[model samples]
Target: MLDINHIAKTFNPGTITEKKALVDADLHLQDGDFVTVIGGNGAGKSTMLNAVAGVFPVDRGNIVIDGEDVTDLSEHRRARLLGRVFQDPMTGTAAAMTIEENMALANRRGKHRSPFRWGITQKERSMFRDELARLGLGLENRMQAKVGLLSGGQRQALTLLMATLQKPQLLLLDEHTAALDPKTAAKVLHLTRELIQDHHLTAMMVTHNMKDALQYGNRIIMMHEGRVIVDVEPEMKASLRVENLLEMFEHTSGGKLDNDRMLLS
Candidate 1:
């Protein structure tokens, strides 16, 4: 469960370069709630995610996750409570590390560190293999291969696995599949759905693809000008088509849909 209460953030405030990223932004996710967030560029999509992740202190707001108020906590302090998969495949995992090695590192995340020892045990390797096999990407067989050798989709899938390995209280996916080709993106998205369901994880996914937004989540939220403009529940979102979403966006935000990428999608 997560709650973002009346959060507002502005960068370079009181200056010519000042930009208001989030204004009176409030969102809440119940246990196992998978919410898809869609908005055009500069719509505060990533800003909201980063704010929850504690990428920077929100100027005004309290973020609570599973009953803990983490608004003042440092990013590293909150990292233990949240799992994030970035847009870039290269961002999450160590390139030179073998798939198994990377997983070993992820497995130890959020745990108390001990400086005395290191090495993957047989049980961990077995668990990692079982988990990798679930992705059906043949990563189980390539456990010993360096992660740098994996394709973008493969790497993203593996990163997804890594992010959920600890079953964090919330999962933040920031346009994670955007960089992959369409076919590969679909595979990664499928894997994402499978993992979230299998773990009963609460998640927020930011996406530019309208169809993907409507097709995947239990709820869909449209953001505009730093605020959540439209929030649709499962039943409503299920019956709604892309054109309907566009119409809602125009009506609610009172601005034309200026995102060409979203339109083309």
Candidate 2:
């Protein structure tokens, strides 16, 4: 579970270039809640996740994870409990490491177990094979290959497996499929839904694809100018349409979406 209360963040405060990224933004996620977020440029989507991930300290307010206040924790400290997959395919895994090595690192993330194992134990190896096999990507056979040799889609799948291997307290995915080809993106999304359901994982995904946001998740949230402008559950508006979401964005934010970067990018 996650709770963010009255959080605010500003960059270059009190200067000519001061940009307010977050303005009293608040959000809550119950255990196993899979919420998809969509917004135009500078809607504070990533800023919100960055605050929770401790990538940067929030200017104000509290962040609690399942009752523990982590507002003041360092990024490395918070990482022990948070699993994140970034927008860039190049960010999550060590490209030089073999697929199995990358996976083993993730499995040992928060543990204080034996620190000198150069290779996976027989049991751990079997577990890794089983997990990779679920993706149906033939990665189980390519475990000895370097991760850098994998295609973007395959790498993303491997990252997903790594993130869940430790059974993280929360999963944060930031536009994870933005860089993949459409066909590959769909494959990754399918895997995402499968893994979330299989593990009963609580996840918050920041996405630009409106259709993807609407199609997936139990809930959808639209953000504008650093605050949630619209939040709806599937049951609340089974008839919701894409046009309606755009209309709501213009309404609650008091500004038409004119950013070509958002509308046409």
Candidate 3:
């Protein structure tokens, strides 16, 4: 349902500070394909997502969603077509808004402006309650509670829920669980798996964790130096061990594995 063709991006072009973030990058996603991406600091994993999101215009390329060409579309235009969750748990939700209030905003997204009531309509309120209840966080009872009062894990969970409220054409998760503790991260990941499968949504998750990368999606793509280096299916990825990934990384990146792997390990 998504197609990226010959995309390229560079920061500070022609200056000493110039960095080519993506070069001839291309990717395609089926209607419900779930893809997990992994790479070190400058592998262009996040750049690919940002490029698709129109955070910054690519120097060249085309972005098509379903069947429409969105290459010239601004970020706001693309926003309605895609849902994104950043690495920072703080980025996705409005802290001051109540749980139901935040959800109300998401629910009404991409609609014509009206003086319609904000917090929750009678029908939507009930649906929100039921959905939040499914998270098992008792958030259904805390509808009026400010999102800021919730923990990081809780907020991320809510972010995940909100992003999917309208079923965007695509979902972009950029290192979504990197900040949480192990247990909390696991919980969020499990919730993520459940939600993605339940909705049969097309998603791309960029992560630093190798094990999680292997265990989650139907496909995995490893990036290095602004391009995709390895794209493997779940069966092939399942046969891969961390050592194999490290070796593959070195071959693709043309350098020794950085200390980040050691630190993460």
Mind giving the per-residue lDDT tens digits that candidate 2 earns over 56-133?
899899999988999999999998888899878887999999988888889888687653365588887889999999
Winning model by TM-score: 1
Q: Candidate 1 residues 15-45, lDDT tens each?
A: 9999999998988888999999998889999
The candidate that achieves the highest lDDT relative to the unseen native structure: 1
**Candidate 2 runs further than 4 Å off:** 114-118, 258-262
Q: After superposition, how far is residue 247 of candidate 3 from its true place, in Å?
A: 2.3
Least well predicted 10-residue stretch by lDDT in candidate 1? 110-119
Candidate models: Cα lDDT each: 0.91, 0.87, 0.86
TM-score of each: 0.97, 0.95, 0.94
Question: By TM-score, how accurate is candidate 2?
Answer: 0.95
RMSD from true fold, candidate 2? 1.6
* TM-score, candidate number 3: 0.94
| Model 1 steric clash pairs | none
Model 2 local distance difference test score: 0.87
lDDT of 3 by residue, 1-265 (tens): 9898989899999999999999878888888878998887887888999998989888988989999998899999988999899888897899998988888888888887542455367898899999898888889999999999999999999999999888888999998998888899899899888888888889999988888887888888887777787778666876887788888878877886554843374
Candidate ranking under lDDT, highest first, comes to 1, 2, 3
- Find the 10 residues in a row with the least total lDDT in model 3: 112-121
